[model samples]
Target chain A: MSKKVVVIYSGGMDSFTVLHKAMQQGLTPYALTFDYGQRHIKEIEVAREVCEELGVHHKVIDISAINQLIGGSSLTDSSIDVAQGHYQQESMKSTVVPNRNMILLSLAIGYAVSLGAEQVYYGAHSGDHEIYPDCRPIFVEKMNDVAAVANYEKVEIFSPYLNNNKSGILKDGLAMGLDYSKTWTCYNGREKACGKCGSCVERLEAFAANGLKDPIAYEDT
Target chain B: MSKKVVVIYSGGMDSFTVLHKAMQQGLTPYALTFDYGQRHIKEIEVAREVCEELGVHHKVIDISAINQLIGGSSLTDSSIDVAQGHYQQESMKSTVVPNRNMILLSLAIGYAVSLGAEQVYYGAHSGDHEIYPDCRPIFVEKMNDVAAVANYEKVEIFSPYLNNNKSGILKDGLAMGLDYSKTWTCYNGREKACGKCGSCVERLEAFAANGLKDPIAYEDT
Candidate 1:
């Protein structure tokens, strides 16, 4: 029997890869996307398309209240501009939504436990650990302990890319025959991705390092 | 200068006491209420009344989607009957919403971080430790560790009644000269509370043990 797992699908490349990887491992995946009023609301549409193509159950939870509850993050606040350059740049810190992963993972665990699923998956890579505190190894371990006590089922959290970078995730996605065109990673949320933003730059670099062209169109690419 | 604290107000006797306790400590309190699909949804209105009387800011978050995600809980599922008798009875286990406190506290932390609140308060008493795992001290410690890593501001979660029972909580509230008449604690939402349900039974016992009459009217009282 295939193990049931809930995938935190954000319609981003990393999450796209996580979904495909879970499928490759013979796990029944439930894609959970949070509509948290992000600048890139278009990612939710892309998530729907990805789930449809993969024949998986998709759940889009409305947590838009988070945008009102948390302010400072460029992703949710229009006053702060999305920075261009690499993920390691100091300005990229504005894009960090405090406790974003913690809140998402907490809800995902509740959904997973309700469904009797044993595992919850998210694509928190080593790259995110630099800017996003909740993406770090210690956060994952501590959150898992919280999950253990929070539910009777003891659902475990799985982050396959925790030790890997975006490039490694891209390589794995390519091996799983995932079509990267369906994914969206631009922070600017334009008709065509503003390929100069930190998210776009990192994604473009990962594709370039893999000796392949990114499938999505970009304003600058 | 008083430190601001966000109190998780459910309009129950316990949470009502928590709000009064925070006020007695001279802390600025913000009440957060979750409008989850609960049988006792009328408690939300009671929460609003309590907040208005206390003159504290109240935030009502819509999280009814949890009812769709988690179905086994009698509190959220209409098909399941609200079990009657003592809270420690085996049938009362059905009232447990998996990870209820964790999900609520996660959002409360986000709200606290947004407002620069240094502490978040909830009324999880020792009486709840038996049926609710999330109410235990170990869970509280682990969740605080997660909160520390999850946010840059590091909002601490405080449970004033963590070591006390329902009777103790009532005693403290009485000492504070709080008007318990506004609080609501009924598993079955109706014109008058069904006094036979586990929640009503426990609450009545607490008031009786404290030599005080519960202010709210009950069908069988």
Candidate 2:
């Protein structure tokens, strides 16, 4: 029997790629998304689309009340502006939601545990480390230990590309036949993705590194 | 200056008693409630009402989406009824919620860390030990070690009545003007609490021990 896995699917390039990889590894994927009152509900919509397209078991858990308690990220609040700059800058005030990955990954583990899934996959790559500390491998390792003791089991939080950059993720996704065009990667919830946002910038850069323009169109360069 | 304490307000009798004790200690209470989508929405409402009456800061963190992921308790699920009669029965199927106390306390600690709070007050009495392993002093001790490393600074989880029973909690509440009338302690949500339920049973017994009948109404004696 195939092992069960739940991917933290955002319908973004990284998560879509991660889901594809899980399928290739012969693990049954349970796609889990969070509606944490983020500014971009588009990613959630895209996530639903991708999950429907993949025909995998999908669950969207609502933890929006978490935002009521923990705030400060651009993704969560209107006060913060989405920065249209490079990814690795400290000036990117648009970055950093408090314990976002921690909270989401915790929920994902909960879902996985509920479904009796042994593994939880995330798309936390080197690209994310420039913005989110929780994306770093050390955090993942530490949280895995936390989950193990919290659940009193051997549940593993597997971030297969924590050491890899976005280019690596794109290549992996391409190999897994992930349709990056179907994915949404913008932090700005505009008519079309504002391609200059850090996420958009990274996505465009990754596709360019693969010697191809990003298939998705954006309102801004 | 009054000390700031994080009170794990579950809207239950023990938690209400804990809140009253925090006030008596000259600490301003910041109430933390977990909205874990239990069949017990009444208690969450009671939590809100109590906190409002106390004029304290209240934060309801929704962990309902991750139910049974950490704890396996009858309180969280409708499939199991709240146990009645003996609390020490080995076959008390109504007494589990995976890791109820651990997760709630961890979230409280997380909130306390953000608030720069030194102490977290919870209601873990000897009366609850017949059912909840997480309510035991030994687990709280071990978890204190875990929290010390899991967080940047240590936050103490204080169970004021570690050796006391439910009647002790009621006695404290009565002394502290807890406004027991507004607080709801019944597990069964109906016109009136089902007195036979574990929670109502306990509450009545506690009030009875104090030579006072419970102010709250029950469908039957």
True contacts kept of each: 0.65, 0.16
lDDT of 1 by residue, A55-132 (tens): 899999887765656677888888888788988989888888867888889889989988889999999999888888
What digit string (tens of lDDT, one per residue) describes model 1 on residues B1-221? Answer: 78889999999999999998898899999999998888767899999987897689998888886666666899888888889999999998999987788888988898898888988999999998989999999889889988888866787999999999999999988988888788889888898988999888989999999887788888855
**Can you tell me which runs of candidate 2 are displaced by over 4 Å?**
A151-154, A208-211, B1-3, B40-42, B59-80, B87-91, B94-120, B124-183, B190-193, B200-220
lDDT for residue A143 in candidate 2, whole number 0-100: 65
Tens-digit lDDT string for candidate 2 (B6-125): 998888888888888888878989998888877758888888887887798888877776663444566777776667755666546455655456556756766776677888898889
Worst 10 residues of 2 chain A by lDDT: A145-154
Chain B TM-score (each prediction, in order): 0.97, 0.92
In model 1, the runs with Cα more than 4 Å from the true position are none
Worst 10 residues of 1 chain B by lDDT: B62-71
Clash pairs, model 2 backbone: B71-B97, B71-B98, B71-B99, B72-B96, B72-B97, B72-B98, B73-B96, B73-B97
- Please name the candidate that would achieve the greatest TM-score relative to the true structure: 1
| Interface RMSD, in order shown | 1.6, 4.3
